[model samples]
Target: MHGKTLTFLLLLISIACLDLLLTHCGRSDHKQKLQKQDTVLLTKHWESPIPHQEIPEGLTSISAASCGTCHAEIYKEWQQSTHAVAFQDPQFQAELKKDNIITCLNCHTPLQNQQEFIVRGFINGDYKTPWKEVNPHFDKSLQLESITCATCHVRDGQVIGALGSDRAPHKTLKDPGFLSEKLCLGCHNVVDEASPQLVCTFETGDEWNANWAKREGKNCISCHMPSTERPLFPGMSKRAGHFHHFPASGIPKFKDREAGRLESMEFTESPVHPGYSPGDLLNYQLKIKNSFAGHNVPTGDPERFFLIRYQWMDASGNILKEEVHRIGEEWQWHPVAKKISDNNLKPKEERVYPFTQLLDRAGTYRFRVEVTKHRMTEENARYNQILGEYPLSIEVYSKQYEIAVE
Candidate 1:
């Protein structure tokens, strides 16, 4: 009778476990189904038609080149910008091929809303998968013109701007967002759901908001799209308006701006001496300051880095000691580390490094400090197979000081 009781208890326990397992599986399946439904709903909303409007005649199809015909000066500035070659950039092309980054293309070569024909993906709610259809009127030959004139300024057969007048060949519409950070957040504030720990792949817009720039009423355009007095159209009146270059760190026209100005480098001897000669046991403090840049230096692209290399050499130029201090955030993906170390400089921030060196001989020595901007770390470059294939250290700033010892 006791043996039968034990068997009956075992059977009851097995049945309970089976029931729990089935319940858990059923909930999981339901959750997945709901997620799918949400995605479908969002995608449908993205494809929905905008309010109908009669497009102006003779303005059916317009391209950046076509705009350039009237706005020649603005066109020249934009031609040299990173936005001009957004889609055809070699680095972008290589990265796309290496990582198979299909999602990035939407931001690089964006589509337009079919009804209003405005650029999509500007607001937070506008973010959707299977991006809106490519602009039907887009020129095939100008496909490489990544953020073209129409990307931000054209909508529904009308030219949009911060302020518009009835002076152009086509209708004009005023958009306040164009004058603020709202226009830049869509692409600049990217969140990678796959990287739960490092969800923000790029946070320039967020950084701007957090910094004093927002308090001072300064926006991304304050520094990036500086205004100049230029003619908007051929034989038109010159007016103070923003340039189209939109210069940022990496582009050639703004390369020097990336590193910011190295304000000052000072070396001070240590107060305490170890009885040995100054040359025998060297101790000093090195401080470097960044005078420019509204945001953090080397702000975008986690792969980009700034390296500070210091070398102690004898009068004969023979290296006695060398050390390298790497600034900027360093991350690893294989082991899934969000950030290994971040020593990057903030705008107008100063960083100091203390050094102690033990030398074998005593003589006149020279301390050389070289700051270089690298597109990516050696490890990242090797992983991407782009090491030495592209521009590695395009901008380098250096300083050297000679020290005498008894």
Candidate 2:
């Protein structure tokens, strides 16, 4: 009887060792392939949620309300943020209907319990090899929370972040890495497998790395997560903390800011050129600078753009002449997805527009400049069928010159 029991125990130990060996070998092989930049294989890797065996103790419910128990202020801010409704955005929903929509959920609603598929491999890529199955552990309620706090703060069944509280309701651990730009790359960095020139997804992180990182020591946290002097928790005393209402292109005012600023607008020869009279030339230079933004003025979604409108208006505010300039990346959307041109303002770069027109009449008029931020192109807007779902454009800068037409 003792020999039979020993044999069974040895057999169990052998299986456990074999499983660990296989898992380690698989991970090593995966790393090697990624170094080769096999995009299809990489796409196969990201088509699933972050792996974890169980929900964190304090986040089992996967509700923002649960975090609100101690983080009331932070929770309110998250409610107003784009991340809170990422999975539920109507435009995104419509766009995802045509293809393998489940792949998108890995980022939009990125929690193990939020997905219905336990993807083993692609039905078609490197990540889709073995096969997929229904996830018996899926929780429908968790799926609706979208990119909730747990998406970043919960991992391996613990509450993790740049700072963690021991007095809180859950097990906490401090991970300084949570504050790094790499954390944002979990979703923000994406390159196209088909067209490498035009990364078809948000390459905000990559842009920051290439254009802004080396020049400036700031990262996404410096902008998106500004410091607040709110208590880490009640009774902890006021101190610097982070929240979710990112001052990026998420809100109307932020859109105006990140889109760039109209530094100044003046005539080339101010004072209207000495002895300027009718039949003479009227000239001026309108200046625009990407003052504060770290990346291109209108980065992120390719659809985002800026419109600069230069106008000559009569005293009655009736426009007599207008010239519009577009600043954004243009793309060939059909036949093949490719970028045609990109004239977005670069970091600290200033563009000057010189205007000259014959002064044909002697009258009082106004030379005006208006800069507006457009969220997307009209064609794409109509296709998504979300023309009026929200404010599509916001006026960023407007200046009028009370001028006398010589």
Candidate 3:
């Protein structure tokens, strides 16, 4: 009798858990689930806005300025960061809609308070497809804050960070995940083997040379958010924290002079050849390297590209012959994104671009070579209505030579 009772109790407990899971699955909002197999649903990820929850205690509001009350320096750095204006960026705003979907907001405005809707859960346990609903708890002010302190460091009303501090006004908890690359994975790195994703972040983290970067003891944190000894906040004792600015390709000079470096230029002319005509063939080689970046030189967004130009001209700098090469990926996104070609430099990789020119009637000729980073093409700029903004193209490297022939 006693054994039968125990067995009955265990069976009942299992049934209860199964029922709870089913009910929970049914309640998810992003991908509406139905009992009928005929029903179809849309998909999403890059994680829905963090569901509505208790804000970290002891902070006045969800505004980053509220955190700035204590973490002054970090807050100020964040103000200058691209994350601070993720949603309000003019170019991003212009490119937000396609097929009438605004799903990109998940990464841009990530906190429930910042989002217009909340994802209760995903249907059929498919996180790729979330079940979303109107969020009664939405705060428009937080939307303007974009990716903020709460988005990364707050959960269940506790402050999550790399180090726990007894001195903090609120409960401080240390999460080792903060120190690893996983922290940036959702937005930067993404689902596995899922190509042609409806929304593409352009695979910045996926392109990273993990084996090489790891051998060097570097990662997203070490490269993008190098740590320093500083007070967690102003009055606290010095400890390890990282820069919040999160700089990368957004800063043109940062990539140009540092990561994508122009290493060397080699030139040769065939002047001593027997029976050589009046034309002196000029042979040139230029080396551009993606030495410092752990990922591809231009990793994110198809709009990002490098333009290499070679020109031979009279001493007056009037162009005579010019050749141009574009280094980047091309894609066709009409039906679904399919990469056509990729010539972007990979980690620690160097590419040599060579060209030849013939000089027949040259007294003194100028040879010029240049590499420029183009953040956006003018055609796309006009289509996106950001043409009035300053040209995004920035010169990374250039060289000039005066070749004299008698």
Error of 3 at 132 (Å): 5.3
90 in model 3: Cα distance from truth in Å? 2.4
Candidate 3: stretches off by over 4 Å: 1-47, 119-132, 191-198, 251-279
TM-score, model 1 to reference = 0.71
Alpha-carbon shift of residue 399 in model 3 (angstroms): 2.1
Best first by TM-score, ranked? 2, 3, 1
Cα lDDT for residue 176, model 1?
A: 72
* TM values, all candidates: 0.71, 0.78, 0.77
Q: Which residue pairs does candidate 1 place in steric collision? A: none
**What lDDT score is found at residue 399 in candidate 3?**
75
Sort by lDDT, best first: what order?
A: 3, 2, 1
Provide the lDDT at 148 for model 2: 82
- lDDT per residue for candidate 3 within 106-129, as digits (tens), equals 778887677776654443444333
Report, for all candidates in order, the number of backbone clashes: 0, 7, 6
In order, candidate lDDTs are 0.60, 0.67, 0.67
Query: What local lDDT score does residue 324 receive in model 1, on the 0 to 100 scale?
Result: 86
Error of 2 at 92 (Å): 0.5
